[model samples]
Target chain A: MSRFIEIVEVGARDGLQNEKVVLEPADKIELVRRLDACGARRQEVVSFVNPKRVPQMAGAEEMIAELAGAPGRSRIGLVLNERGWDRAVAGQCDEANVVVCATDGFGIRNQGASSAEQIATLAAIAAKRQAEGGPPISLTISVAFGCPFDGEVSEDQVVAIAQEGAALGLAEIALADTIGVADPWTVRKRVEAVRKVIGDIPLRMHFHDTRNTGIANAYASVEAGVRILDASVGGLGGCPFAPAATGNIGTEDLVYMLERAGFETGLDLGKLIETAHWIGGKIDKAPVSGLSKAGPFPKPAE
Target chain B: MSRFIEIVEVGARDGLQNEKVVLEPADKIELVRRLDACGARRQEVVSFVNPKRVPQMAGAEEMIAELAGAPGRSRIGLVLNERGWDRAVAGQCDEANVVVCATDGFGIRNQGASSAEQIATLAAIAAKRQAEGGPPISLTISVAFGCPFDGEVSEDQVVAIAQEGAALGLAEIALADTIGVADPWTVRKRVEAVRKVIGDIPLRMHFHDTRNTGIANAYASVEAGVRILDASVGGLGGCPFAPAATGNIGTEDLVYMLERAGFETGLDLGKLIETAHWIGGKIDKAPVSGLSKAGPFPKPAE
Candidate 1:
């Protein structure tokens, strides 16, 4: 059976947040231009957080204003609290992503809140969004697989949080392997369990290639009926709080596998690789994508 | 259900062959000692070939004779022709692995023989082994997934070769993604097809992490009920002939996935990572393994 998979491009937001080099607003806009040229219809373009704490993400409002009102593209803004949520709504983001950590250790460190506080805040944001009528909002459960500070995260913890998140009537819900400690079998089992709790809500998956299991986890999620996956161009981004955490699965690498297996990902492989190298140059880091170095199959006829 | 899978380490031979630095026989032996320390029961320690052709793979005779007849370890010698096969038999290798290229383009460049000629050589060697009662022989179909020279190797091509190889009463048959171009879905289908042709014979898989699909491909192979997989320490190895080809799947990386997924791989993940770093130091190259850089999960109490 032929399938269509949506890869939510995260290179502009999650990708650059962990980079040592900060991109200016114009450069960030240029990066989004390349992503749009590569046929990315949905992208996580900004995180509405304290720029003082994360200087790399200082120009979210500027980038969002410049990126506003793309006809077909949906620009998502990640907001962890009500203040950030207000900033996202004020910025006219196409979508808002709410992140709730599965463990208190990661929650306190990453978002300056506890797991229970994040869930309660998710409820408040959903209620406010329902009354105020802003852009669509989705919930992402971070550290659903494992946490760097708290050690192993239990599926039961993630399931309970997903069950609560599903009750909020959001657009979609994602399970993020924030530390990249997920295996395919564990991913399949967790996806199946989380599906039982969140009925009819589109399940998205976010993975890091920290232990080289990101692609495999993505494959398992797809096989388990997850349609939306988060990827970064050139495998950019890492968890600054999570020790030794690396970049997300490369968008071109994911597209390469999907297209080769007869799945339509609505992505151009040549352009993706080209953009990967382009972003790597912009960030002054080598692209961690395999397709960039290995090149596309069939040798490109020359 | 619980399961047991075997990982055949290939660091010493395949892992080192593509390195720019040529290792001495003593250093190669030191590498094997590390492999043995990591509880690798089966390893492709050496390849019998012309030293002039592959200088990195020289001193195979000395290394094999020194490592002859380990109590529980099975040292496999890779042989491409009748002459190498004779050398394998003389070296008292625990097992002999004969390689037959899936395409004529690769067969000529890699082994100086056509596909049909390699099959003929396989048949002759099998007959001689049957008459002489030497070490057990296995067949490996190199580039079973894709060929760098020919490109897009068909499943029918591999299945036909596997059918012939199975008919020769070999120990096991392996499909090598020599250029690391295979995807998980394709791997499952091809493994099923090859299994139908090669009845009851064990199926092994060798993958390179060239395009970052090796772990995914290995997970697919195990799910398809293929027990044996080939990995190299620190994810070493590349194709001298194939442009931009990189390392195999890291033994530590594979073990981390399998052990986390509850499959018995009988490998020490810690030792594998240590060996990856050790070999990288010996060769003066940083390991390509994610685990070497990311470290193991659960924080290791540090």
Candidate 2:
């Protein structure tokens, strides 16, 4: 019954982090600024990880510095450990996001720890940030739908993770379909269980269009009372560990479907699609968003 | 809720008609036979229009004759007027389909008549078929959601047209999103209205994936409790009149979604996807079906 949805623009951090090309800090800043201008309030601008491990995210600090204090926009920085948390505080992001993989295989493969250890670290950071009166912390559970190494992640695991995140007093908990293997039924089932476990804590959904069910799953989540969605501009970003995994759901495509389905996203679709095409040209690949390929409905005048 | 859904495969006729290259009749027959082998009971094999007008539909008679005695499959042929209807009867198609455009602009442009005139002609054809003990007649209302030249198409018009089609006692009535301009909201609204007007007469849905809303719209229609759907294998077919128009929703993609959503489509997903890829190679471009591009979910083992 909720009519308003908040879209979290994650192209800069999530998309570019996996892209083969290490985009210049200026390009990342420009992309974030463009997204902000198009009415994106929550922009995951950068991830403060080891530059050696993720060279694509090398300019996190500089990107945050450039995006700080932008009008009517919030800059979100990703923090994986205590060191990353220190960098996020120094960068003065509006919010800090910590991700804990749902499966131990993925946790060790991605964050070099088990899900329990990572959740404990994020809990400590959440406690520290709240006491220090710094930026709020949000928890993202990666591979919430299915894991590449572990395979067939159960809804019970995701619910347990969400309960831990809720007990930590995180502001938001995002269930990520890391490999884009979720269908609508699974999305509904998991969202229902997770919501029951973490009552009153806002739920966010992150989906990949790898199997072309991202939009349908997102719509199901909306019907299940979820308001926050994570998408990337130009459909960039693919999971390196997941086989046949494609990019994240296109922000403009999701926005278009949301608006057409009678939900208010508070984002400009025209500007978002234009930005997608522009950035796609820079990356030297055609955008995979359906709206971009088909153009706007009702056939905009020639 | 209906557990069984019938899929009307239209790739052979609708897809190849609009394609640039002409396929030999033997190839068309092969495609239809393969689709039949994959559990498609309803296949629109060809149209009975003038060969000179539509060079691609030149061998409708030969194609039908080749498929006349196929087991457990009903071959459908399109008939625009008396001549086409005569040809369909002579070809001994299992069913005869006539399309009445919703708007006069489209009706005149596509069928060379007004909506009323075309409806009258189709009604006469239906009566004649019933009296002559010929194939059952089905009506397809093109542009039921919106029109290219006429712009917005009112729900009242569609309801009125459905009322007329219902009066003819046709076997089935299909509401087509001819330009793929429909979203979930519009699909729900139009389907609700049309279903109310034509009670108990089977309703089929035809969706185009132009703006990428086709799959979502189809899902919405299923939630609306419609039992039959029209799809093109390999995601072929585009409207020449509607700008930015794309192909119909892919049969394999729809089957995958429906089966995942717990509906029985009676079609083999593996065979359907394989047939899509095989047919795509014979065409000039890649297949537009998303399932083809992403492969099936769960990666179905190496």
Candidate 3:
């Protein structure tokens, strides 16, 4: 097992996108800045997509542009198409993350494209990014474990998409339990399948705490040799397309678990928790993170 | 891995004991009956503690009397002393669970006895039960991972308590993360240490989701070959002795994870979720169980 794990902060993009209240560009920038100051080395600061489709992400370009040349952190931007990919590169994103829906049902519902069409678009974007030769690209297979519209997603389907991404020479490929419907067994199986196809490509995991299996799945993923995990600070995430989706795994809670399990995350837990509390208050609600709810566990005497 | 896992439904005792509002004795009996009807094989129905100390458990004898000879389930009761043990047997409890603290501080505060004194009492009770041949006793070590007063509890302390219980010929031994301070690594290490001392003795696990690692620890326990898991319906549990100690692992949520991970728990997920919702409504609140919140994961078409 790796002694260290990299946490990709996604609260600014994925977490806030699902919330009912849309924060101003300034708030989004400030949230990312606070996270960075608290040792967030890599983060999803924005998503370059159609504002009409996702109004919460209206000022993605502005958010990224404002954070460009910032100190000590790498900014990632979510892009779903060639156009969005172009926008992310223009805005100086350190990494461009493209998501392909695993099942056709979710692809159509979420992105208005079939799975094949989405894969084709991703292939074009990958080619363009490879030619551009600066901002690295990564692929996230959404609803890889299970889809709401399509109940059971086959491992073969997920691996097929991963293979497409691997062929593009993407830096990383992530499997997202978009609807939080994965057990550890499924997580292990899917991760193994994807790894078998994409031999040396790094794998990341995205999980939601909707059914309360997110932490368990995360642990399973870690045991399966996954190193990069995407989490929201306050567990602030849900699916706009998938019905009844809830929070992503809370970053503070995830960090607590990882650090206790002997994985060095290099993030200050106290500061992260305070950040969750602050943002939750600014949003006029309690944070959904369980560790935030439980306060901090007393550290064992060294 | 054991395909079949034993879930000891603890809603009636551990679940309700932590709630601020007390339920009527009849309501408690009805809760146990419903759990049994939903195929719960073993349950902690009530605790035979002093009514004045814990008024919520005021009707332990009456509740057990009402549940005595109830069909299709084994009822267990918590007993702290010889008096409580006598009451449990008289109330026709199928098993008596006695908790011995792993640290002196928690023992003094929670049970008004040192760890040594508690073990001595348990040993005497174990002798009597062996001679009488009924109502098998089990020992639980609270704060087996870390204690609130004592910062770090030694593995030797936990192993020592398990050794004492093993010498007493207890039917099973459970190590409880009383304050939910255990990580998966600690759980695996502790379970291994205890197993080394008490070979072939059935080991049970009790986890509080206080620090949000309960489900993760439970998964690790299962991977470490643990079969019996204790959980509360609706996540209804908190340690009255340990400040800020929160709910136990939610039974419905745990069952969902286990069954999906290919462990057959012999539990009706739908019925258990319905029971959670019913009880939560009866208490005029929503259930904390995640499965009850998200509804069941859609089963694949056979």
Candidate 4:
């Protein structure tokens, strides 16, 4: 399909959160602005978590406060609990993304909560948002494909979570391959199962490229009628809880695939590669994105 | 479709041909043996080309002669011209794989011929093999997606080559993304187009992960009813003619994707990763295969 697909740029948030190098708030802001300039309409700017737990995601308030709002750009703030939701509201984030886990083991290790407990937390925040009128919220189910400790997350587990999530009237529900263990067939079937249950809340997909199945999974999602996806510039970020967690699908790589295939992502490929290089240098690591290393197709007419 | 998929291991030939450090003949044979032990039934073991042109692919005869015949294992030799085909036949290769390029620029640079000239050479070799009853042969169209020297390769060019190839009654035909510039939708469409022209001829796909679209392209090809695919162990190899040519799609990564999605590949994932590690050690470079770095899904019960 040659339709428009929304790419949620997570380079500043998910891309940097799991990185060892803790970027300065100014550097993080600069990274977000650079990606925004590259036509990232929606971006995950910060995660409202304790600095002790995720040190790299420490500057939620400062990062949000410093970023001058660009028209039509949504700065997404990631939240894990009610406190994180309050922080997102206080920081005036364009939107808030709260996370629930498909497996209890990942929920406990990643956010110090069980799966059921995380859903309860999500329900509470949704109710508060409905009453207090905060930023629109979306729920990401982590380990929706497979788990690091539990392993082989069931389709029933994810669908059941999505069902409970749909009841909350959230803006969106995302199935995340937290450890990148998903296959395309499973992805298509799961997306179908989730779609039958959720009616039309608009499904978003988040995939890690740890095992290199991210692009295949994304392609399956797109074919299964998903229009929104999460990607990181430079293929940055890895889950600290998951062993050998590689970056999310690279924003540049995803753009190259979609644009080449005639799908409009509204993200500039050339600018994305440059942003990858800029962030890669900030982290003192070369971008793992394929487009960043290989350059765009047709050689760009140097 | 949970059908059995045949994965052709090319780590020894296409994988190592463009590498910098040329391995000893014994090492190359060892590498082939390791992959065969991991259930690689058909493998591209060497290329019958001048060592002066491709030093990394030298000692094709010695490597083939050293490999003891294994039951059900077919050792494939890649040939570019009539001389190379003769060498492969003389060397007792179980299969001779001839090359026909989709573009003239890559053919001239990589094989010292134009596209038409390469096709003529392939036709000549096919005729000789038919008359003499030599080893079963296949044709690989390199840079079938895009060329480095000549920008975009059209579907008409590749389909035309496949039509000419099918007329030779070849055992198989492969479409290779030599520069790794293909996307999933294009791959699906092109595979369908080529399949229409080459009736009942088992279509094989070869891809490079240079743009990180290899897994997606492979997934699309499989969805398009392609059962045979070419992949490398440890994600090795690059094209010397194409700038920033990365490794082929890793066999282990492809197997993981297929087996996890309920497709039978008859390949061992653990052994494949070990072979990747073993080969990577010999080359003094880490295997770039995603499964090599992330280990297998479900963590292999470790």
Candidate 5:
């Protein structure tokens, strides 16, 4: 097995934020505690976005405050613009994840800006954070693979955004398959291209299992020298913009594949599946995670 | 696009024969007719197994006789033992598919024999058919990649068995990933091994997408010079012995991949998805095919 790969647990923030039913602050805190107990060192705990636009994320400040007092684990928050960034700094999140979509359509729809404008804003935030000696910031480039409305996002656009973030000294850069349209070859090509431009900054991958290629794409990225992966527990996250998009690559499922292929993921499969089953109980429907339904491979003898 | 790959539609026999529900003979006939209408040149319509054990396949004779009367398509029947060979000969199927499990455990469980014993039986049947000027026989080596009871099947065993089958003058040989446990690296190595042993015989791949690695493995096989593929409509087959094994590579899904990669499959994606939907309705559950759910890539405008 290679050196331990960091699995930044995103289910608490990215997973729950997309749910139609807003979760209570208590439930959000409990979810974070449960994830911490299951060996997740880093977690995206909340999004510091306005309640007017995203009602599900309305109580982000309270959720962050509750989690800040919780024992164990490092917490991060997602932010789209300077308002969210200000809230993230005020909430004292250990890290803040700023996102910029690769295409114009998803950028306008997700963050209310063009790609160029969003990149400029993200660069300014990164520069300001660098100057303030504040908490570290990561840049997640959403729709780096493709877009629902725009279609076929070019590698040049993704490279330019990644290079811009790299120049601003972003802590990490994550390329997201927001619409779940990337194949292994495309993932390998894009990751290599981005790596060439960025020159050795930490790279992460986030993929959706919309067309059932998420896990394979994740492995391909790993083969292309990516160590950090963003996955929701039980594959809970889905893009509200892409109608057919169903789930992200399940955390337990990804761990199973990684552990089996001689990689150290630092996750307990049984406990993660139990967490998935627990979350599934709280949600309206059961998720489509493979490990949850199939259980672990090579079951113990009765 | 490369030359058109022959996708052998095996849902009618391999897909439904293992199901608990015994579909009506009319429904079975209609399923085959619909698959033929969707431009499937070769269809495995039924199995010549004993009804006492496999009751779902009891009406194989009736189905085969009816489909044999149709024009312009090759109708094949899956045969297990000498009794099945007798039945296939009597019914005059366009082709008789003889199966041999690569591992001893699955061979005994599936066909009640050892691998060598099954190969000898197939050789005897092939000789008899040659003497009688009967239709060609194709041998499919099941579990060529890996087995459930016996983990990590060796390529040596697969090649040894395939060499014997090739020596018997079999028309074609297929390597079945019965448990869906193969990765692309494994597929390439194993396919290359079998190709070396069986000189000029056309190789076919039968893969199950249980672990979501099937299409990627199929792509690797295509890159390894394989032109024939076995897919159940709607990704519908699983080995009775391997628990929780579901979703063979769906015909529509596989065609979508092949067509997108600039390979000709001679399949109509629209018609294929429609037929899969029809089959799903007949079974009273939507199939687990990604293409059926997500539609073709670069989805046409509404």
Candidate 6:
């Protein structure tokens, strides 16, 4: 009944960014269009990074140009530094998602900076975008739950970064469980801690289903008052930087949990599963989504 | 560390009972011995059921007798009806686990009776066991969280049934998430409801990892004051009667969560995983445990 929950689809950018096989720009555009038609108002369509480092995301500008005339969807581009931000701005993307890792190892590996420097850089980018009257920007703190390098990230560290992002007037602050090691208790505690520091700021959760606790952790976050969630269609995304990092929480699976728990997700789970199935066919690998394999709950009697 | 948590390993019985392939009685006895040597104080050895319906549990008598002589371990046997109870008593089991389904559809399929009839039968068996000075008996209500046939089992119904079991002076009561459809909220609410009705009766949780929420739900139950848990070694068990029901939550995986969350499980997770791997080899399939595949959290840097 309530339409408060926002499903920020991140499959196209975060999901496809690390693939060994590069997709054509036209194929990326078609994927965005399909997600929009399936009721995704916000989609992370591409990442603005160097072509040599991440060849899969090399055609970000071209893909953006293809979808520039497409209607009814807000396309967000993920950016790592000033150069990436400039690329996103020139591409005329609707939003920019800047990330700052909670630990030094991941921050350096992901963005080649210390945690403090990364936060400072993200804040400067947010400020610069505001100064130029550019599109809105949001900051996501990755490895907020636990880091592959630094285990058990403290809530205080996450809160401090979120507060800094809030001070920069960021659109939203999301806590990313980059490695999928967070349990429900950790999720609830971290989300609550961040909420205390960034009062009234929209908070989102990004979870990976590495250990199969992703959906449960997401539900725990929802109970702790999180509304926006980041998921990959068919559980497609994983961090190429973090060792053994698995797929993000599948969008279809998340929708199933939300709708069945009496929350409105504004997405068709059956259609989402079908889309995941279709995408899996294209990728030539079966998805790891439980709902796709197990089907919905209260299975019809034989 | 507080050694308060006890994991009742049920793979030998509840886990093996549902398999389509029938294992030899000698193999079953060897599995029980291996689990006991791994520090499982309580092992559910076998189920005394009709061989025509459940061929896997056909040698319950011989398996129970062999496991009863096992050094320093309590051997538990499952019984559905009064006939099964006769077999358990004849086998001289250390404990008898009586089962009653929370909903009518599951009750008929599992126990061939209505909920009321099942409750009455369980109460009568408890009273008779006490009067005869037989072994201590524990009652576990299957589908306590939700039933595959009936969606959304009410907390009131579960509490009433728990009260019925408590009135019979059952040594313990376990609530089973028969179909793996419960979230953390559902687990907490139901456990709290049953706790309110049956004061001071030790509560146990039997969960399956079919939908990947099993360990999280178990954590929630533990937070809600349930100390005893049922886990299948290597995630072995599922309900043969419940269609589409997958493996139970793995004991090694459960222990990992408990120990990491600062709860003392008194079980060595690495040894448990090794035991699971060994058992999996015997069964001709890899164990369905995530921790076995992912390794423990906070893995040492390479």
Estimated TM-score for each candidate = 0.98, 0.94, 0.97, 0.98, 0.91, 0.91
- Candidate 5 lDDT over B121-193, as tens digits, reads 9988988888876667888999887777776688899999999999998899999887776676678788999
Better of 4 and 6 by DockQ: 4
TM-score of 1: 0.98
lDDT of 1 by residue, A1-302 (tens): 33999999999988998999988978888988898999999999888989998888898899899897899999999999999999999999999999999999999988999999999999999999889978888999999998878989999999999999999998999999988889999999999999999999989999999999999999988888888899999889876644455689999889988888889989888899899988899889888888888887767765
- Please write out the lDDT profile of model 5 over residues A79-154, one tens digit for every residue: 8998888888888888899999999998898788999998888978877787775568888999898788788789
DockQ values of all predictions: 0.65, 0.41, 0.55, 0.72, 0.37, 0.40
lDDT of 3 by residue, B198-241 (tens): 88889999998887789989998998989999998888877664
| Cα-based RMSD of candidate 5 | 2.9
CAPRI class assigned to model 3: medium
Model 6: per-residue lDDT, tens digit, A1-302? 24468999998887777655677787777777777767888899988888788887878888887765357678998888888899888988888899889999888887899999988888789778767866788888998888877788888889999999889888888999887777777788888888988888899899887666777688788878899999888888655544344588888778876676677877877677777777777666676666666666766346
Which of the two, 2 or 6, has more TM-score?
2
Runs of candidate 1 with Cα error greater than 4 angstroms are: A241-245, B241-245
lDDT minimum window of 10 residues, candidate 1 chain B: B237-246
Clashing pairs in 5: none
Tens digit per residue, CA lDDT, model 2, A1-302: 77889999999888877777778899888898889878899999989899999998988888888887677888999988988998999989889888999999989988899999998898889878877866888889999987778878888899998998899888899999887777777788899999998888898999887766777788788878899999998778876754334589889788877886678999888888898887787777667677777666656667
Ranking by DockQ: 4, 1, 3, 2, 6, 5
Best to worst by TM-score, what's the order?
1, 4, 3, 2, 6, 5
TM-score of chain B of each: 0.97, 0.97, 0.95, 0.97, 0.95, 0.94
DockQ-wise, the better of 1 and 4 is: 4
Q: Mark the regions of model 6 whose C-alpha exceeds 4 Å error after superposition.
A: A1-3, A18-22, A68-72, A238-246, A299-302, B1-3, B69-72, B238-245, B300-302
lDDT of 3: 0.86
Looking at every candidate separately, what fraction of the true A–B Cα contacts under 8 Å does it contain? 0.62, 0.36, 0.52, 0.78, 0.17, 0.28
- For model 5, state the Cα shift of residue B264 in Å: 3.0
Cα RMSD for candidates in order = 1.2, 2.3, 1.9, 1.4, 2.9, 3.0
lDDT for each of the candidates? 0.91, 0.84, 0.86, 0.90, 0.81, 0.81
Candidate closer to the true structure by lDDT (higher is better), 1 or 4: 1
